[model samples]
Target: MDLDGLDALLAKLDRMDREIEGDVGTIVKNNTIEMTQKVVKNAEFTQGYQTGYTKRNIETKIVSNLVGKTISKSEHSGYLEFGTRFMDAQPFIFPGFYNQKKQFLDDLNRLVK
Candidate 1:
């Protein structure tokens, strides 16, 4: 291809990259949420903890050109994670990210390509 053609191709790639990045973030967020829900379902829920689980939700926010997603339980999520007086720690957050890394990259690759 000529230089002009090459330049046009590069410009198109850059544009596609921007679009793919934004889309990939959403895809990652949705998939990660599934993992979070599974972990929550499998978690050992006592009396109070069970109530807390009902408040679980996911949120997506934008910062400049980036999209950020959060899987939130409640204000007491930290207490459940670290354990309080009579309860043991039951982590449900970090594990949500376990399957997301590879899936995110895969989505980026598929969308960008």
Candidate 2:
């Protein structure tokens, strides 16, 4: 091919390569944003589950302890104090609590993913 023609072809190829690179960069950026959003959403969900599980567990323990101690139902306002103390004294209760929480959270996570 003539030198002028060869040069023009090379220039066109360079422009095409630049366009392809730009497209690839856009795709990567979009994917990265999507991935980041998903991670944030998952983290929020996990935090919510942990908070709710802890609250319910505390309530249960307080009620159980108060009843066991023969505290009058009229005097106890839902056993909040007892629950807090019981949970503080026993850390292993968390695993069983989390296990029950996991069933619901796992289903939610599966749907989200």
Candidate 3:
């Protein structure tokens, strides 16, 4: 091809590379957050019974630095899940992650394709 046509082709390829990188990065980040949210929801649902306190307060939040995500609860929430000496540990968060781990991987895999 002539110099002009070759230059045009290179420019397009470079733009496409940049765009694909941006899109893939966004997709991965978003998918990760979504996966965390689903895990948190699973935990909430399986958290035994709910009077709307613990379950309602449960949250999935983005981690800093575009790292990933985290699941959290209100300050008093720790007591309900892990319990103080006066109470028993009900357990919720870890169990939720466990149940949804497979699905999380699946989400990432689909993004690759």
Q: Please report the TM-score between candidate 2 and the true structure.
A: 0.39
Worst 10 residues of 2 by lDDT: 61-70
lDDT per residue (tens digit) for residues 1-110 in model 1: 54668888999999988878678767766665565555565343533355555344434334334454554546666776578888887765555566556766777787
- In angstroms, the error of model 3 at 91 is 1.1
Comparing 1 and 3 on TM-score, the stronger one: 1
lDDT of each: 0.60, 0.38, 0.60
Model 3 weakest 10-residue run by lDDT: 62-71
TM-score of each: 0.57, 0.39, 0.50
- Model 2 bad stretches (over 4 Å): 1-4, 47-113
CA RMSD, predictions in order: 4.1, 19.0, 4.9
What is the overall TM-score of model 3 with all chains considered together?
A: 0.50
Evaluation by TM-score, superior candidate among 2 and 3: 3
Q: Give the TM-score of candidate 1.
A: 0.57
Error of 2 at 60 (Å): 41
lDDT of candidate 3? 0.60
